[model samples]
Target: MEELDVNVSSSEAFGIAEKIVLLSFISAVILMAILGNLLVMVAVCRDRQLRKIKTNYFIVSLAFADLLVSVLVMPFGAMELVQDNWIYGEMFCLVRTSLDVLLTTASILHLCCISLDRYYAICCQPLVYRNKMTPLRIALMLGGCWIIPTFISFLPIMQGWNSIGIIDLIQQRQFNKASNSTYCIFMVNKPYAITCSVVAFYIPFLLMVLAYHRIYVTARAHARQIRLLQRAGNPAEPRQGHQEPRQDHQEPRQGHQEPRQGHQEPRQHPPDQHSTHRMKTETKAAKTLCIIMGCFCLCWAPFFVTNIVDPFINYTVPGKLWTAFLWLGYINSGLNPFLYAFLNKAFRRAFLIILCCGDERYRRPSILGQTVPCSTTTINGSTHVLSFFFCQRRGGGPAAPGLAGQRNQRGCAKVPGGVGEGNALFPQSPG
Candidate 1:
């Protein structure tokens, strides 16, 4: 075995003042992240309405990461602030770095997924998006993100993790045992950090920037079209002389002037409202994903540069500051729900409905209190059974079911009978 660098001393990279500031920042970030992500998870789990689509599923996955960071990273980080040196053993250091790498990777991948989702949705490629972005596919991507890096992280520990073969910790314990004090693992190698940044940060980053740029271009086109249409008409009287050829009018609505009357019957198209909403949603969601990606890059970029570039430059900075910045990137997991609500109508509606579920209407007298969506599954053999629970609107007044929106998992609005309210007999996508 290689001799341990136990006695190798590293210069103190952080002062007490810097440590205090970093601790404060990360502590604030950790607390907010925990609450935000917990709210998202609870709302999704309690309300059946949030799980109807791929986007919400991704949101939940991100929340899971945030919860993990809060549980696993924050406390250790706080303790480390007080004790500048690692009191915890090599094992914990390894685990810490591994989890940090994996979770951050997953979060970045989520942002990328969201950007792709937005692109397809806004670009009118629903079938392609739906076919490609399955839950199983997402699960595999997440698995790959975790398993691959963890394998890489443990590679240099004793030997290549692949070469180490299956660890029979059970049997190993029978021989020479590691100390009980070896609970924390942070002794990660530099290769793992560099590789993590490349795969998890740079790749996803470039992809999101490209996707968002395209989305912005497309959205600008749509905005231009909408403006032209708006300018060409009077809500009261239609404008004249600026008309297009008959081929363009498409189902001239029962109202356009007679010149457009004989226009070849415009092709019957899908619902305009639906298409418009989808386009708007995709554009906004893409932008949000880009912003999230930007945040990730900003947080991780400094640490990566410091850690990687410093070796050659022999440059050193405050380790506490760098560590705090790195953890800050993980905060994106908690911000996802807020981003979704801000950028996507479906998510916003889901959040609103879930919030309203606990009201007096549903709680006391009215139709029902606020209710959020949860995943309920009964797996028997090859098939799966899923059901959603609905909560009535908040105001203790009558809820016109129409106002409740489409019922399939998105709405989760149940009538007096088991029947649902909205016309959508099936969810846009299965859970």
Candidate 2:
């Protein structure tokens, strides 16, 4: 008997320790999601350079959705886990579950919006993008992101649309005295589950994939064009008079090259350096956005896939496994902050300033001629500067009527080729 009693005590102690560790882990995740996303919002709002960036509006909205998930959804999910049952009333349970769906859907949709914004900026008409994506239009888009999810999630959940007609097994289980009435579970309505999954995950995912693919292809084509231009331009011969610009955008075939037969040479065409610079920007942005999208897929896909499958299987998925998937979705909110810090230079600079209270790099020069040494590296052959409005304007390009209005803007300059103009084929940096 004493031996049995000792084993029982040890088991209880182990269970308690395990619970503590679980609680601590969840708490850490929630804390990270809150702090990291909050920092993003603060940095964008506070920094002069970041504030001027129009695309960051979508980023701020995304961070807000993630922050809401951390505050409204994760803590309640943690509560249910720790207590081993939902202690809150059914009304609050419905509210909490609705928030879970709404915030995460908002996060995914905001990503879609960001992808679209980039697509227009990098691939569409610059004037159209600037005109259409103004502050009011962006506000409306953000409003729709939240409103659509609210209608799909909270209202339907309250109206019992997520619940199927009475199930004999679930009904019987509910009446049993030993069954936990406080535990919350979806009622496995096939139509509702499928519809929600399609709207929330599948459609937006396809759009993002298409946008990024086009962005990638466009960047590649620009790089190839620049290389051909560089190889074809010859400086050895001088022309007698200025040559007319070629109208054909197509390049000469490698095997079909011909030498100048006359005693004159091709006119010395100035370097379209801004075209190369814009291509690099487009490529970098595409890469960074792709990484973010990849992370989103890895984090949320499992949970959503399982959620859809559970209904088809009559919700036979084990409670532990279901909860695990839910937590996996929540993990995304925490991961985004770290991803931003790593991939985005501006975010890293902002985070360092926020966390360390100040950055020496941003500090002013001391008196008496003392100055802080700042080292810079040229990445990918360009002198890298942090431009919030990247690859949207250029200097040295042929001045166009379309770019005349933009010329007054800071960092707008004429570059070789029609760089600052509204040409879809070439974009220019704001540097």
**Candidate whose lDDT is highest:** 2
lDDT of 1 by residue, 332-420 (tens): 65566566443443344445655787554332222255342321221110011111122333333443423222222243322221101
Candidate 2 global CA lDDT score: 0.62
At residue 125, candidate 1 shows an lDDT of: 38
Worst 10 residues of 2 by lDDT: 372-381
> Each prediction's Cα RMSD?
13.3, 11.1
- Per-residue alpha-carbon lDDT of candidate 2 for residues 1-431, written as tens digits (9 for 90 to 100): 33422321221233667779879999999998999899989887776555665656777888999999999999987876676555677678778878888999998888788777766665554456668788899899889888889877988888877775734443443222333334554554788888888888888999988987776676665566555444433323333133324313334632243343221221223333443555565456556656777888888798879878976765566655666677888888888766643345555666677777887875433446642111111211112222212223344554442232233233342222211111221121122
Candidate 2 residues lying further than 4 Å off, grouped into runs, are 1-21, 166-181, 233-286, 340-342, 363-431
Residue 314 CA error for candidate 2 (Å)?
Answer: 2.1
Evaluate model 1: give its lDDT: 0.48
lDDT of each: 0.48, 0.62
